[model samples]
Target: MTSFMEDYFRTALSKELAIAPPERDHEHLSSTSRLLEKQREVTEAETLLANQKE
Candidate 1:
């Protein structure tokens, strides 16, 4: 009975937390590129601020 209850709970949790498949690889790549662009902009801004302080 204990083993049966454990299996039931395991199955229920598995279904509840199932991972969804990625819909599109292109969308992921574009988002990653955008993130990199934002990081570059931030670095440039920091450099400009440091130079102005000197």
Candidate 2:
């Protein structure tokens, strides 16, 4: 589940990065990228915690 979320967010980040200059907002883009990365990390940690309980 965590790996899946990480992959999905990475794909989304790539798509967002591919936009042309005139269509992109650098600040918003950077914030979104950072947020996605953080979310991915949290998901991975949660998955690890869950697995350790088994």
RMSD of 2: 11.0
lDDT of residue 27 for candidate 2: 62
1-54 per-residue lDDT for model 1 (tens digits): 997898688668866886654454455577777687668669867965774574
lDDT of 2 by residue, 1-54 (tens): 998898788668856875332444546667777687668669877965775574
Model 1: residues >4 Å from true position, as ranges?
1-29
Per-residue lDDT value at 23 in model 2: 42
Best by lDDT: 1
TM-score of each: 0.46, 0.46
32 Cα displacement, candidate 1 (Å)? 0.3
Candidate 1 global CA lDDT score: 0.69
10 residues in a row with least lDDT, candidate 2: 18-27
